[model samples]
Target: MLRKIIHIDMDAFYASIEQRDNPEYRGKPVAVGYGGKRGVVAAASYEARQYGVHSAMASVTALRKCPHLIFVMPRFEVYKTVSNQIMQIFREYTDKVEPLSLDEAFLDVTENKKVMEFATQIAKEIKQKIHCQTRLTASAGVSYNKFLAKIASDYNKPNGLYVITPEKAEKFLEKLGIEKFFGVGRVTAHRMHELGIRNGFDLKQHSEKELVHHFGKAGALYHQFARGIDEREVESEYVRKSLGAEETFAEDLHELVDLLRALDDIAREVHRRAEKRGFLAKTVTLKIKYADFAVVTRSRTVVNYLRTYDQLFDIGKELLLQVDDIEERKIRLMGLTLKNAGTDQVVLTNQPLQLTLEFKE
Candidate 1:
């Protein structure tokens, strides 16, 4: 039997919530984040996207793109509340729901509580309930597997629904751009271009052995994706691997005092989040990105779990001091992370939906 999957992606989740709550923001270009010189955009409304304003872009750059863009500080607590409401609605249909983030999730409705015969109907109902209850719209994609379902959801825009049946999956994939394939980032896509792989048809021309030699293990997955084959299941039990935060400075820092001060702030924020999430780990890692974009990291694994803010900060300070030529090189960004002593589980941070799903799968 084919597995029924539906991928639900909220349209500009943070920006939409703001618009739904505040009448003044509706139909205007809005970005959710600080507008300071050092600020980065967390989310951008579709209107703002038209002007090339997007999340992770510098606030200064976003403003340059859309001079009238409005900036609003993030309200995570309120977003979480709305997310819970959405998750409860998913539970109403199926227990096999895998949340990719606060905004999107994947539901295995093959054996749903509603005993729905068609996956498209389930996706339609879910989208309706979300809009009716929260006054925010969602786009849904339905198919036999997670990959097609995820791509289907994004096929349509806000308040849209799309389905990729088994019969159509092959032709649809053949015409799909190489960039749309799973695990294909900018760098990988560039390499594929050099090899003349522009679309799924081009990728299909390569044998698994040749692809594996080019992309290592990931090449094998690409070979499968070209054929519209994704065997991964919708995982409901997600274990967070690490917790941390990073900040990019508008101005580079070369002084030891400034670097230490920045590390202290990052350590404090990481500790606060860890405490809030009850995430405990024995290893602390410090990351440094130089003004020239060169990156380096230092880590230390202690016998005892880092439980106190002081402990996390002290370890972070030690790691920072251990970096090579820290005082000589100008630093553009600093980050702190906590993880288990000897595990290599992938970490899921707030990245683009494509990048996040790459790690989740």
Candidate 2:
């Protein structure tokens, strides 16, 4: 049976919230983040986007692009409150809701509580309720699967609704650029372009085996996506396998001292999240991304669950030191992750085993 999925994404969530609370910021270009030298934009208003200012862009660069851009600090508590309100609205229609972030989620409404025959109607009602309650606009997409629904949500922005029916899915994907495909990041897109795979049609020309040879495991996903087929289901109860936090710097750090300082911040963030969720793990993983986009990771499993910030930071430092020729690389991003030890034990126990027969051989 075809699933009825709806993806809801708020338009410029933080920035819009700022504009709604402060009328002075309504018509002007606004950015939500710190305005310091190393600060990055967390969100940008539509007005700021016109000046090429976007989220994750450096604050200094954003100011250079639009000198009049106003910066507002994020109010996460208020955002969470609004998120809860919207999520409650989603539950009124369907219990199968998967939140991607505070501002976006996917809902499986094939068997909706409202018993609505049309997914589009549910999407419109959800958007209307969000506007009435929060005074903020959201964009919604209705389709038969998660991938197409997400894409459709972004088709029109800032209080927009779009639907991609089963009949329209193929043509919609065929003309879509490879860069717009989910999971095709900058590195993968460049490789695909080199292989003459610029769009969905180009991608469909390659077989699954050919794609896998060039792109590894993700190649199979691309092949399926090109045909407008995704078998992934909407998981309502998400089980987190790991908890981690990462930060990207506006300027690359070359010195060990600077890297350690950045690692301290990331470690604290991971610890805070772990404590908040009551999550315990026996493995610590450190991820480093160099200025040139090369990435490396080091991990260590301990006998005991990590329960303190000191433990996390110490393990992360040891992992950092294990990297070869670290001084030669300019680091742009650093992250720390914690994995549950029991999960590994379960995998080992489930593995199939073969017995050797020396006499038969």
Candidate 3:
């Protein structure tokens, strides 16, 4: 069967929430994060992007780009609520939904409730429902597989939909930027460029063996991606990959004592979530944003899954201390998430779809 996959991503998730709640923020440049000396933009409205502001970028740089940028501290509780709303909408169609983050997810609808002939219609309906229910716009991608669906979703911005068919897949990928390829990060893109592999076409020139020799396990995946082939099954269930909490203070934190307390709070929250979910996370990750806007994460994966609050907090504390510029940097937010060892959910669907009656056990 030709698998039907759709990728849905909310447009400017955090910033959209801000715009939704505050009518004044509409059509204006707004950023979600502290605009302090050590601050970073957690999310930027479309207007802010026009001024060169972006998420994960330093507030200082964003300010330099747009002095009039309006900054609002993040309200994670609200974001989580919105996320739940969208997730519920997704479940109405298919059980095979894989969430990429709070605002993005992939749905496999080959066998769905609507059982619609065309995935495009399903995508359209989902988008419409989101707008009707949440008053927010979402971009959607419809294609045969995951990678292409994801690419299609980003093809249009703000509020858009794009579809890639099998025949058009190769051509569409050829024009994609190296940075746009899945799993190709800043470091990987640079290395690919150094090897004269700039785009999908360039990536196709190398043999699987050559790529494996050069890039290890990722090389094999890239070899297939170059040809628009992704055989990865859509996992219906997945263990909690990370457990962490974060807070954006109303006031910027500039002292070590205060920072420790925040970190402790976040770590405890992470530990609690992990314990509740029975997560086997070996890696403890700490993410921080300075008032100056520079954001960084330090993580150390232990041999065993960390379950206790003490273990998680101790590692997080060590990581916090490693940031030598902490005192000089005014912190606006701190986040901790646990990365569990790899595990995939097993689905049960191969059984016959017929009804059976039994008289005796």
Report the number of clashing residue pairs per model. Answer: 0, 0, 14
Ranking by TM-score: 1, 2, 3
Error of 3 at 85 (Å): 1.9
lDDT by residue for model 3 (303-351), tens: 7667688888899889999887888878877788777655532222311
Question: After aligning candidate 1 to the native by TM-score, how far in Å is the CA of 307 from where it should be?
Answer: 3.1
Top TM-score model: 1
Give lDDT per model, in order: 0.86, 0.86, 0.83
Tens-digit lDDT string for candidate 2 (248-284): 7767898999889888888887888778766778999
RMSD of candidate 1 to true structure, Å: 4.4
Backbone steric clashes in candidate 1, count: 0
Alpha-carbon TM-score of each model against the true structure = 0.91, 0.86, 0.80
Off by over 4 Å in 3: 245-266, 276-307, 314-337, 340-361
What value of lDDT does candidate 1 attain over all alpha carbons?
0.86
Q: Tell me which of candidates 2 and 3 scores higher on lDDT.
A: 2
For model 2, name the residue pairs that clash: none
Arrange candidates by lDDT, highest first: which order?
2, 1, 3
